[model samples]
Target: MLTPEEWAIVALSLRVSGVAMAVTLPVAFGLAYLLSRGRFPGRSLVDAVVHLPLVLPPVVTGWLLLLAFGRNGPVGGWLEAAFGVSVIFRWTGAAIAAGIMALPLMVRAIRLSIDAVDRRLEGAARTLGAGPWRTFATITLPLCLPGVLAGLVLGFARSIGEFGATITFVSNIPGETRTLPIAIYSALQIPGNDDAVWRLAGLSVALSLAALVVSEWLARRGQDDRAGHVL
Candidate 1:
């Protein structure tokens, strides 16, 4: 059981991760479709660049984000000047860092799903007067539902554990940007916050387990649906 403050951290973690996943889904799907199906120059480069965060150290990624999106940075300057939105030391900034960390996983999962979709089904839909968009919506999308769900859940889980980048980018300000993992790290640093540390750890474990179970259930459901159609 968590204290009220600890519980708030857990809830904030979930909200941040969930929002990150939600934001990543459509973007991932679009990127996956372009990678899996589209033809263009520099495609390979684009793919590699998208996956760069996967290989880079978390702190490096965080620093890069800070450089690119900091209040004084180029894009950050433009965004702030245009809309008065500042990402530095903000919850939204934490989510952005989490999203960046989660992007490769989301893209990989979605790409695999897009590849698994039958091109023949897409052709069949086209043959039946479906436009490109309609065919994708009615055929390709449904077939790739399993992968989409898996990617969303995986992205959420990744976001939950994101600390190095998040802390570096957003500074873990309490109640604003201190997620569960951040809280855990801070508590463990204290001399006698053992109870808080243990409770946060337990919460982390439970959340991870729940995410795993949900992913498994979604994958199994997809398989069962496929089996039913086969029968």
Candidate 2:
């Protein structure tokens, strides 16, 4: 017997994760493009920092976010002063934490795809009177759709399961920051809620598996579409 609150938590988790992925995709793609195609100083350092969250413990990432985005912290203070808003202990904050954790995976996937794209195709587009942005939009982007889809799906799935960073930064307040992972954690904390935990855990597993399947399907479909375009 699932309560309304639990179901709400599940829906909210999906929403937050979806939004996080949506928010991360463009930024990831742009960064990936820059890393793949742009020749710039400090590029290596930028790449390293982008992947830092992937290597660091989620809790540590959360702590860094807290330090940087907390009310008294510099950037956080500026944001608050400028917008009269706060991210700490909020749903938005949880999404940001999850997004940071998932960004490296997203960027890596997009970067690889971009790298694999045929540069000659882009050059051909330039020869046909296309600007850099036009070539990217028409040729590079279409060819790399599979990787972009993969990155989006991966980031969304990761965001769904986000726990340590979210809890550390957002504090797991029920109905606000209590996402699916937080809900599962809360369920396990109760002595007689093993069945509930099992149910939610099953749901979580199903969601993750579904996301994986969707990613694969989208990747394959993108490949097929590209192949057809070539034909």
Candidate 3:
């Protein structure tokens, strides 16, 4: 049986990961679309910047976020002063850190999906008098739905497993910013918490496996759809 605290951690993890994925999806789609289809100055730079979090140390990324969103920081200060909002040492900061960390995987998956789309098909729609938004809604989005699902699952997994950046940005606060990974880390720091660690570790492994399975299922489903389209 799971303890109340464990259940709280699990529920909070789900909430944080869900929120992160929700916010990241549209931004990921936009970046993927730009990378796959748009052409303009500094495109390469933009691409590099989008994937920077993937390469940088998690701690460094967290520190940067703190500088940008901490209580004393300009953006954070203005937000607090204007709307009484706060991100530092809070759940919101954890979600932001997780989302940023998950962004590269999200963008990569969606960009590949977008690239696989048939431009000729889009052209046909345009020839038939459909505007860009209309064609994208009816054609492009449907074709890439599986990819979007895959990206969302992958991003959710990443967010749930986030640790270094989240800890740096929000610290470990039970029922607030302490997520699954942080809980696991906290378990490790105490003596005779091996059982707790193992239990949490099991949950983490199961979550990761489920994410992988779903992602693969979505990929296969996308492939079948593509085959049908080709036929």
Candidate 4:
């Protein structure tokens, strides 16, 4: 019973969230690994910086992003001049906003998994002539796969639900930046648009719930798998 426009909005939301998660996954893993294992100076500072968006107002985050990545901003200007790329007011910008908003959750989940890994096992692998990179690839990453996947799901859910940051960065342009949350907000502004609001809101709830359920299932399955492996 959804209209074509509604379906389009849903599709756009999925695309933005999916792309955001995909783009953030590797970066999140790297940061998680660093935070969980590295002992470099300024580590606390780095961690705080990484988690800043979580505590900062969404509008503030969005405005900061605008300052950093808007056409006139240094990074954005460089990108535009050197690569002819412009993310401002585009779907790409929306993806960036979603990714930033979801990063802390992703990093935290992955970091916890990394911290739970057995350092002794890594040492054993090293004793067997496995290099750090090799051991990480063969042991650490596999052990933490479940957490990484859970993080991705959680991040995807966050991305889909993103509103304030996305709206500020991308302006809710239809067929571009108007995700499900934005669509719902749009519907709410007009009179007698209850049906549209309800439909979009329902879809949003379903998607978020589905993501959380999957994340939980993945975490539980991971625990079971680790237990069986130990046995």
TM-score of each: 0.94, 0.94, 0.97, 0.96
Q: Model 2, stretches more than 4 Å misplaced? A: 222-231
Provide the lowest-lDDT 10-residue window in model 3.
222-231
lDDT of 2 by residue, 178-197 (tens): 99989999988889988889
Which segments of model 4 are wrong by more than 4 Å? 228-231
Worst 10 residues of 2 by lDDT: 222-231
Task: Compose the digit string of candidate 4's lDDT tens values, residues 141-225.
Answer: 9988999999999999999999999898879798989999999999999999999999999999899999999999988977876
Please give the lDDT score for candidate 1. 0.87
Cα deviation at 149, candidate 4, in Å, is 0.5
Across 117-220, the per-residue lDDT of candidate 3 in tens digits comes to 88889999999999999999999999999998999999999999999999998999999999999999999999999999999999999999999999999989
lDDT at position 118, candidate 1: 69
C-alpha-based local distance difference test score of model 3: 0.93
How well does candidate 3 match the true structure, expressed as C-alpha RMSD? Answer: 1.1
RMSD of each: 1.6, 1.8, 1.1, 1.3
| Residue 199 accuracy (lDDT) in model 3 | 92
lDDT of each: 0.87, 0.88, 0.93, 0.92
Clashes of each: 0, 0, 0, 0
